[model samples]
Target: MSFLFFTAVGLLAATLGSLVGLGGGIIIVPALIYLGPYFIGKEVSVATAVGTSLAVLIFTAFSSTWSFHKQRKVDFRSGWLYFLTCGPGAMLGSFLTQFVDATTFQLAFGIFMLIMALLLIFKGYLKPVNVRWAIQRTYTDDHGAVHTYGYGALPALAIGLVVGIISGLFGVGGGSLFVPAMMLLFRYPPHVATATSMFVIFLSSIMGTVTHVALGEVDVWMVLGLAPSALVGGWIGARIASSLSSGKLLWVLRITFFLVAVRMIWEGLG
Candidate 1:
């Protein structure tokens, strides 16, 4: 029964995560932390929960990325660059987790989620600024629609470093930051940003998971229970995302972030 419940949660998390290129860690980590005791008949530590989520995310991200790749939505060059730059930070964050208590970490995660929610809500009202140092690139979507965009490589690397650290620390895939950064800062199209973010997430997650495993933080049984559902959910989510308009996708992302923010705050306060 616990396995079934976790599998269901994984399905839901993976669906939303893949749809938004978040790699499902936001949902997975919180769910494991809050619900694991009740469902699994034992208390699960925050670190263990986070590590398990990251392990499961490996499958979810891969599944989603594959779906996006099929549609020619992934920007491999940018994704690889972000992945490479993010590695060091992720390693550092994983080590730093030892110094953080569960309550403090939860509070910080809540604060971070709140900020992301606000950003998503106000994204449309924000004005765009031209970045003079941006590297230009062109991409053709599955439908042969060409998109030309520019972004500063330095800025992206800096953002990736931050995102990686947060991901390792919080057990999130960092898609919450990455997708928005690419769309708003790099001027990427929404779909392209999401797809590219997923690829980057996959690579970064692998690094984080390895660090967690070395720390003995991961729950292998939980990961096994969650992975299958996550894979299927990820594939389904990517398919749905391919059909959604950018506006609709952003709306979904905003609403989800708001809900997560509220939950995180409640948990943190408790």
Candidate 2:
């Protein structure tokens, strides 16, 4: 009976996380730690909870990436860069988990989310509808080579490190931060940013999972049970995102980010 309940939660988390690019940890961690144990007694450990969450995320990331690939939106070049930075960062963050309590990490994450939410809300209100992302013609660089570019690598690297560290601490995929950073800092299209972010998440999550395994934190069965549903959810989200306008997607991102922020604050306070 308890397993059935967990399966249901896994399905829902996959669905929501896929659409939002969150890898379901934002929902999974708290739900498992608080609600799951509450209903099932003290059977599960914190390590199991975190491990299961990552397992589900693995599916979500894989599914989402495939979907994006079909749309030809996955930019391997930029994604590789994100992978290089985010993967190491996640490992570093996960190792530090031993020093700080999850509650403190959650609170700090919550504050970060709140600040992002405010900026999004204000930006939405302040920006004119006429303002849209414009695609400029490719430019030539030194050596007379023509390239289509948006922003520099230094900025992307800096942002990736920040997001990667946050993911390690919170057990999130870090897409929430990655997407916006790509869009705002690099001025990439929304879909492009999202696709790239998912790819980066794939590498970072894999690294984080490795760390969790070394620490004896993973629950293999739980991950297997949750993976299928997460895949389905990712496919659906990718399709929906492909069809929607960039503005609508931004709105969705904003609301979800705000919720994430509130949750973080609550976790920190606890």
Model 1 ranges with Cα > 4 A deviation: 132-134, 142-144, 246-256, 266-270
Stretches of candidate 2 off by over 4 Å are 43-48, 119-149, 245-267
TM-score of each: 0.93, 0.80
Candidate 1's residue-wise lDDT over 1-270, tens digit each? 797888898998898889877888888887888787889888888889888888888899999999999988898988888987786677667767777888788888888877877887887777556664457888877677887787777888898899999988888888888988887777788888989998988888889889999999998999999999999999988999999654676677677767777777777788
lDDT of each: 0.84, 0.69
Q: How does candidate 1 fare on TM-score?
A: 0.93
- Which one wins on lDDT? 1
Residues 101-123, model 2: lDDT tens digits: 66676677567667656665665
The 10 consecutive residues of candidate 1 with the worst lDDT sum are: 125-134
The alpha-carbon deviation from the true structure for residue 113 of candidate 2, after best TM-score superposition, in angstroms, is: 4.0
The residue pairs that clash in candidate 2, if any, are 107-268
Error of 2 at 81 (Å): 0.8
